[model samples]
Target: MARNREKEDVESRFNPPVSISMADSSISLLKLISILIIFVVGVVIGLVSSSHIDRYFTFQGDEFNFKNTYFDTEQFSHDGQKMVVNCDGEDCLSMESFVRLRNLNHRLRDDELFWRASFVPQKEELPFRRVPRVAFMFLTRGPLPMLPLWERFFSGQDVEKYSIYVHALPGFDLEVSNSSVFYRRQIPIAACRMGSVSLVDAEKRLLANALLDFSNERFVLLSESCIPVHDFPTVYKYLIESIHSFVDSYDDPTRYGRGRYSRRMKPDIKLADWRKGSQWFEMHRALAVKIVADTKYYTLFKKYCKPSCYPDEHYIPTYIRKFHGALNANRSITYVDWSQMGPHPATFTAGNITEGFLESLRNNGTRCSYNSGKTSICYLFARKFDPSALEPLLNITAQVMGF
Candidate 1:
C-alpha cells in the first residue's frame, strides 16, 4: 500500500515530473484561445472605423454640379481680338492649357501660363494653428450690425493667430474708424446683382484685394449679412483645418451644382463656359490666389462670365473644377435658404427665425454624436437673417458654440 501511494504522489508532481508535458499542453491551449478572441475584437473595431473613414474622408463629386446653361455670341476684344466661344461647356480647354500660361506668360500671360502667387503660404512661416489660419473674408454691402456679437466671439487673446478681411461695397463707404474692428480692413468691393458678371468680377476683385496684404492659409468667404451660428473659435478651427468644405449637393444631375465656366473662358469662347452658385464660399488659400490672379482664364471669364449670364453663380466653381479640381473641399460654408426656387434666397424673417430654426441651421444637416464630432458638419454662418432675428440668435449663442 505504501509503495502504491508513493508512486501516485510522484506521478502528480508537475515540476520536472511525469505530468510536466500535460501541464504545458493546458497552458498552450489557454494562450491560443486568448489570442483568437483578441484578434476577432481587433477585426471588428477595424471594420467599423474603416466604414466611417470611407464615408466622411472620401471625396464625392456630387456637390460640384454647376454647369453652363449658355454662352455669349462670338465677339472681339477692344484690340480687335475675335473670340468665337462655344456655348456647350463640354468644350472647355483642359486645365493643362493654363500650365502653359504660367510658364509662357509667367503670370498666366507668360509662356509658363499661370497667375501670380495669391493664396500660397510661405513654407517657413509657422501656420497660425498647427494646421492653418482661417481667413474670414466677409463680402458685404452694409454695416456689420452684429459687430457686438462678433466682438464678443473674438475675445482678444491670441487674436493675431487669425485674420479678417472685409470686402465692403465701394458705395457703402464703410468707415474704418478706431471704434470699428472693421475699420481700415475693407478691401475694394462692388454691389452684387442677383445674376451678373459683376458678381464674378467682385469675387475676383475681393480675392485680388485680399491677396495684396493678408496671406492666410485658408480663405472663408462670408456675407456681411450672415451671422455666426457657433462660437468663433469652434468655427475657426473647422474652416481652417477640416479637409471637407460645407457646400452641399447630391449626385443627381438635376440637383448637382451649376458650375459651367470652362468654354466661355476667353481664348476658346464656347457656350460650354458657364457655372453658377451662391456668391459665398470657403477655400484653401492656394485656390483663393489662383482665382484672383488668373490671367488666361480670367480673360476668358471676363468675356463670358457675364453680368447678363449671372457670372457669380458660374465662375468660381467652374474655374475650381478646371484648374484645381482636387484642392476644393467641394463645398461652401455660408448658408442661404433657397428652399423655394426663386432668384432670391429665402430671407429669414423675425417670425421665421425661431429657436428651432436656429438649432436646425446650426446643425447644418448633420448630427453631432460623440462619435461624429470630429467629422460633425455644421454651417459656420447663416444669411438673409431679418435684422429682427438677431435677438433670438444672441439669446442662444453660448449653446450653439459648444457643439
Candidate 2:
C-alpha cells in the first residue's frame, strides 16, 4: 500500500493537472475572436449592399422616364459644359437644366471653392475654338413685359450662342409662350425687394446659375424694364470681343455715393474704396466667377449696406473696384436717364418711342473710350420702358433697331 501511494504521488507531480482559470481564459479568447470575425463580415456586407444600391439607382435613369441617359462622367465634368441628353423619355432640358443649376449651389458652398474666391488660374489656350456663350440674366418681379422685343432680338442668333436665366418673384406665375426665349428658364428664387440686400442676393443667384455652364463666357444683368439699343451682331461683337467689363465705378461726393458708406464696413471696405453706379452690369467669365465665389466682400456688404446704402449700387461697384478695377471699363453700357427720377429712372411711355430717341441713346452725339484710346459707341441697352410701349416699339423694330 505505501509503495502504491508513493508511485501515485510521483505520477501526480510529473504530470500537473490543467488549470481551470487558464481553460476559461482560452474559451473567452476564442469567443472574442469569433465575435470580431462576425462584425467584420457584417461591415463588409453592408458596404457592398450600399454600393449595389447606388449602382441600381444610377443606371435606372430609364425607370424615371429619362432616355439616352447612360452614365458618362464627361457630361457632368467641370460645371457640366458638355452635358447632353437625347431624351426620348422626358424634356430633360426644361426641368433638368434647373436641377443641374441647383446642384451647383452645393458645389458653390464647397469650403475649398468658397474660400479660394480671390482668383482662379487661367486655363490653357486650346487650339480649337471652343467658342463660349453669353448668359443673359433677367431679374424681374413677374412676367417679362419686353419679351416680344427680346424675342425679335434673339430670333436669328444660334441656340448655342446664348442662354437666358430669369429670377422672378417667388410664387409669381409667368405665362409665357413656348416660342418665347424666356420660357422655362426660371431658377428657384428667394424673395427680392428692390434697393435692399435681397437685390444683391438676386444678382448673386443669377451669377451662380450662369456660372454652372462652363461655356458661358460673359454675363449680362438686365431688369424687366431694360431693352437692347444695339443690334444683336453689334452687341455680341462689342461684349464678347471686349477685354474689359462694363461696370461703372466712380467716386461720388454726393449723398448717394460716398455718403452711403457704412462705418461698419471699415478695414475690409474703407471709405476710399466705396463707390456707386448703375445696378446694370456686364462682366467677363473670370469676373463673374469671382463674383459668385466671393464671400469676403459680399458678407461685408450684407452686414452693413442696408436700405439707405442701396447695396445693389454700392456692393458690386466697391467690390470690383477693390479687387478687379483694372478689368473694367468703369462705365455702364446700360443707359439710364436719372435726370427725371425720384428713386427710379425716367420711364418711357408709348409716345416716347421714336427712331431718333433710340438713335440718341445709342450714339448720344459723343464717343466714349473703349479698349484703351479706341473711341466707339458707348451704350448697348436702355432701361425703364413702359409695358404699353411694346407694340409701338415692335411697330418700328425692323426699321429702327435693325432686328
Candidate 3:
C-alpha cells in the first residue's frame, strides 16, 4: 500500500492537469491577439496623420504654392468674386481654373503635354483690333549691368508695341524703380549652367512665360551681354514684319557639327539632319509655341546631347531645320564675331565700340534672303559685348543706332 501511494505521487508531479494547461494556452493566445490589434490601430492612425499633414501643407486659401518657390500668389476681392493673381500679372480666371492651366511639374513629359493642349488655334477673326507686341526675353545670370542702356532704348516708346521678360537665376530680384520696364518682369527660372541642358530649360521657360500673353507675336532671345544694334522701331519693324524666323542653322561636316551627332538619336535625328549655329535667335510666335510644345525631339536632345554636344548650340538649329526649315531664314539676327579661333566668339569691350564697328555689324557685307528678296540689313542685335561697353553704347544709341 505504501509503495503504490509513492508511485502515484511521482506520476502527479511529472504531469499537470489538462484543464490548467488549456487555460494558460487560452491566456497566451488572447495576449497575442491584443498585441496585433494595437499594432494595426497604430498604423492606421499614423497613415491618417500623414495624409492630413500633406494636405495642410499643399494648399492654402485657393492658392497652389509650389513649395513657395515658382510663383507668388495673391488673393483679393474683385467685383465680389475671389481672384488670385500670379507673380507674372493679374489673371482673371478663377484660382481653381488657373491652377489647372498652370499646373506644371518637374516632369518634362507632362508639362509638354499640358502646353501642347493649351495652345489655341486662331481659326476665327477677332472682333476687337489686336495689336501685336514683341517679347524681348533676356537670359541673364544675375543683375543686368546693361539695364540702363535698355531703358534708354525703350524710353518714350508706346507700351502697346512691346513687352519685356527677364530670366535670371532663381531667387534673384532686380532692384529697379517702379516705373522701370523690367521692374516686375522677372519670370520663374531654374539655375542654368553653361553648355548644359539647363541652359535649354531656361530658354524654354522664358518662351513659356511669354506665351502666356496673347498679344506677344514675336519672341527674341537675348543675353545679358547682348545690346540692341538698332533702335526699338527698326528692330521692331525688322522682326514683326518678317515672314520667316531668323535662326542660324547650317550643315557642317566638321568634327564639331556632325561629329556631335549620336547614334542614339537614330530614327528621330539623323546624321544628315545635324546642324550647328549660334544660340542667340529671334523666332516668330508660331515657332516659339512649337518649341515650347515639343516633347519628341526635345527628349532626344536632352538624352543624347550631353557635354561637348552643346544642346543650346545644336538642338534649336537642328530642330528648326528638321521641322520648320521653310519658316526659318537660316541666319541669326544677332551678330557674333567668330574670327578668333577658339571655343567662344570675340567679346567686344568699351574700346571696340566704334562707329565703324557698329556700322559693320549693321550691314556686314553679307547678303541674305529677307521676305523672298535679298537684303544686307542682316543683324538687328550684337552679342558678347562686355559690361564696360554699356556707356559707349548708350552714347552712340541716338546718332548711330537711331533709337
lDDT values, one for every candidate: 0.58, 0.81, 0.82
User: In model 3, which range of ten residues has the least summed lDDT?
Assistant: 97-106
Worst lDDT 10-window in candidate 2: 98-107
Which candidate leads the pack in lDDT?
3
Off by over 4 Å in 1: 1-132, 176-179, 189-194, 213-215, 244-275, 364-374
- Model 2 lDDT per residue over 1-403, tens place: 9999999999888876679658888999999999999999999999999999998987685555443354344455586567554443232445445323424323344344334333444657643345578889999998789988999999979877788988889998667887877777887677988779889888888887777665678899999999998888888888898899999889999887888888888898899999988889999988987887877888898888888888999888999999999999999899898896587789998999998888888789778878867665899899999999999899987887799
Q: Which stretches in model 2 have alpha-carbon errors above 4 Å?
A: 1-129
Model 3 agreement with the true structure over 1-403: per-residue lDDT tens digits:
9999999999888877899889999999999999999999999999999998888776663355442433433455556466444554333344433322333222444375337434865657754455788989999998898889899999999897888888888788878999998877876667888878888888888788777666778999998898888888888888889999988999879889888899999998998899998888889988988888888998999899997889998999999999899999998888888889897889999999889999998888989789989988988888898889988888887888886
The residue-level lDDT of candidate 1 at 318 comes to 62
lDDT of 1 by residue, 148-194 (tens): 66666666635555566666666776665575555566654546665
TM-score of each: 0.60, 0.73, 0.73
Best first by TM-score, ranked: 2, 3, 1
Model with the higher lDDT, candidate 1 or 2: 2
lDDT of 1 at 16: 62
lDDT of 2 at 24: 83
User: Model 1: number of clashes?
Assistant: 56
Clashes of each: 56, 0, 0
